[model samples]
Target: MRDKETRLKRRMEPALTPWSGTTEATDWSLPEDLLQQASRRLSILCVVAAVLWGIGLFIGNSFPPRFAGLNGHPYPWPGNLVGGLAITAAVAMWLYIRLGHARPATLDVGLAFLVVNAFAIGLLDEWAPREVRNRSVSWIAVVILTCAMIAPSTPRKTLFAALVAASMDPIGALIAHLRGVAVPAAAETFIQYWPNYAAAFLAVVPSQVLQRLGRQISRVRDAGSYQLVQRLGGGGMGEVWRAEHRLLARPAAVKIVRPEVLGAASESDVRLITQRFMREAQATAVLGSPHTINVYDFGVTKEGAFYYVMELLVGRDLVSLVRVFCPLPANRAVYLLRQACHSLAEAHSRNLVHRDIKPANIYVCRMGLDYDFIKVLDFGLVKFGDRASTRQNLMTADHVTSGTPAYMAPEIILGNVETDPRADVYALGCVAYWMLTGQLVFQAETPMKMFVEHLHGTPVPPSQRTELPIPRDLEAVVMRCLEKDPQKRPDAAELFQMSCQCKASVPWDHEAAREWWALHLSEFTRGLTLAMPAAPAVSSSPVTR
Candidate 1:
């Protein structure tokens, strides 16, 4: 009976509920709406003021003032017309702000200037002595001037404009104090000058605001995405960080924009960097081979910070590997090459060409020697073929010569940006040559000369440089890959299959090589003490990391 009760209680237990996403939505503010409202109000006031001022001019002229001819201007007609327009502007500015429309901050600033000018003219009329064509003290002018200085078409604009307007008062007072006599009309001068100062202020404000916006954008972008554990390193373009995704909790590497490569949040540079970033992600994601780094996700953060999330690789790059080990054992070299070719085959099948194929781009993972994982990195400089021309913006001409010149093909060196799979095959040949000889296929002190050699010169055979026995069949394969004409080069798919066969035959060749080396004992021994200046030992290090 107790066991039956326990079973019934266990069956009643409920499953745990998971979290669901929920957040309030906000609207995007556009500045154009505010401008329209301001313009409409200004037009109405201008029409009313023009008609009233014209009637006043005739009535006042027909009936002479009891006091004098002096008013705001030496000629009363001119003053009346100018004063009317100024007063209208003040009312129009007030109406615009009261309406509370979204508009660019410039229009608000302009409206404040217009209103301030009306008070400035009125004060001039009141302050100037009888000989200077002044009239009566205007109490109304002070109220309008104060309101004009403080009012703006929007809350953000009003606060900033008021502070700016308030600052002008102290400056005007300082100048009056410095001159040793009170300029009784100093406040009026400040009202007149406020617009000019405000114009300058507008120019300075946006930069600081944009910088703040950029920081905020960065914060938003980083929020709940990935956390940077540490910086990896940077290059000509940007820095990379070791990061972790918050949800999946997977290790990833995040790349950030470099200050040198960008000005604060430029739409153009940002777009280009974003494109390159997405291309890297798309290429690696679609390649989807174990030999290629896996891209988890990529996007720009709210803060204008661009980053890509990719599976964190632990192995050292192939460049370091090749440096430690000069020429690898023939069997081992063939095996690694075959794995790389397999990755390349997959990339080619997807219509993608890893133009920047080099030692640094290859990763050799040894944690699993039995399952030796060779990963490729930095498809950042991939050749997007026809897709490039379609872009409205082509920021730089660097793609034509993107990869290490020593490894680039003749077709690429000749400024052929429309490179194809054959260009990649040629780079593959360069890598193979480097592996066999423990040296660059073409030697030059400068990039230009190296490029010229690739375009117009022939590289020495790998066996000649390394003192290794060159099988005629292998030589033919390497030569075909390095063929000057792209058409003559074997496709990566074909070469990948060939590399498979090459690795498989290595076991059989070992037994045969023992006998063959015996017959050519003197020749084989000559390679043992080969003059190796920068030749490192056979490094298990991967070149194309």
Candidate 2:
């Protein structure tokens, strides 16, 4: 019997040899289906976010509690929500981020929808009786549902958000029905409760979020001296992960390029792109300020992927923030621009131009009672003043242009590679224009038209476009950056200094923006947004200059 058992164990040994390690097979590599599901969910969330935000703002601004329009509820920061539905969507957004799962998937669409309708129902304040509040929510749900029907490019998220709003509506209606209102068929009640029930859906919701972040984090292993966490984002080229220093638990961003991309490249080409990518990191990584994201390490993985670690930011991108409350006040605009200039100038000093300087690229780490940390990302489109030929070019990776066309300069569209700091200056001008008006400065009907406008059409200054006060210094800076002539534009470093000098009413020590805005507004007060007591209107002459 012992001999037979030994023989059997010997046969089983080969099977266990491959997976002898601690982690499971799926742990190292994600399943195809899981990836597809995550990707689809992300796409759906994108579509849903676009729709819900558009409607939320419209309903929020158009409805009662009239102050809520545009810059509605007055929530201290950006926009405020007087209605319960808008508040609910905000809560879902809050939950999404805190849990480290702000994917805004189909599930979020449904949750956002529910939150909006629920908010409108007066569930939180309940100014009137429970039944009255419920009825209000039910009515709001109808309006939300109708909007969803008319929306273009409806995805799973849109459907889900609509369903969520619908859930609140039925419950409100049911309460009214219970109070002896001549109700429709009992079939409607059964239908409301069909898919987890609508009459009281909030009871089951509110706290049921699948924060897979912990699960993702737990999967990281403590190898060597340091510990590693879950991966953040990567494309066909590379991946980035969060890691902790062994000695100090300080967090860092670890960027990685998979072996396949590096391993197969010729040594010369590999060195070229590697050097460029590293140069990109070094150029902006060590700005050495809270406003600037700090790069800690840059190295290749055991598998031969190149990686760089930097400061991991917390908070939404400026794009998300603006969608809620846009057309920032001139003083507020100056404050943000000044901080951005500080960082960009540092890059410009090294002759580095951040080609992709869009709202999505700027992250707001902390919105202290009045201040925030803005970290820039995706400098892949960076231009090195002296080094023209990059490893990316050597490989002939793809034919597509490196940067987003919307932000690309006139010189770039004309296929100018010797493009210097002026290209980035154009992008910065575009960003400044966006903040002041909450609209793209060179917006045309199509991408083709947008590109053409950059070549031909003249952008109207912010002062002329919106009600906001436009500082001449700020105006000079934007126009100079957008100058058709590259030499006519100021290098990012010079621009940064100008920004620092232009808005100086507030001391660096004084972080109180409200007081700063109030004081500065009196000097050069320009109103922002389409709402409020309305800021003073200002305009500029059509410039052929």
Top of the candidates by lDDT = 1
Give a tens-digit lDDT track for model 2, residues 287-362: 4545566666554332233455665554446665567566776666666776777777776666566677877676
Task: Tell me the TM-score of model 2.
Answer: 0.48
lDDT of 2: 0.52
Off by over 4 Å in 1: 1-224, 247-249, 263-267, 367-371, 385-400, 467-472, 503-545
Per-residue lDDT tens digits of candidate 1, residues 1-545? Answer: 45643543342221111111111100112224333554555445445544554565556465555436443332354555555665666566546545763344435555465345534344334332334432233323343333332223433444455455444433534543454534446666556445544543453344344334433344334533877655567655656766656666465667665322444244554555655655565556666577777766565543334456676655446566567655655555566677788888888776677888877777655322222356777887775555564243232444545667888988777766566777888988887777777788888989998988888888777777876665556666787888899999888889877765663335533444344334432222233322211112212222222
TM-score of each: 0.53, 0.48
Worst 10 contiguous positions by lDDT, candidate 2: 536-545
Q: Each candidate's lDDT (Cα)?
A: 0.55, 0.52
Cα RMSD (angstroms) for every candidate in the order listed = 16.5, 23.0
Number of clashing residue pairs, candidate 1:
22
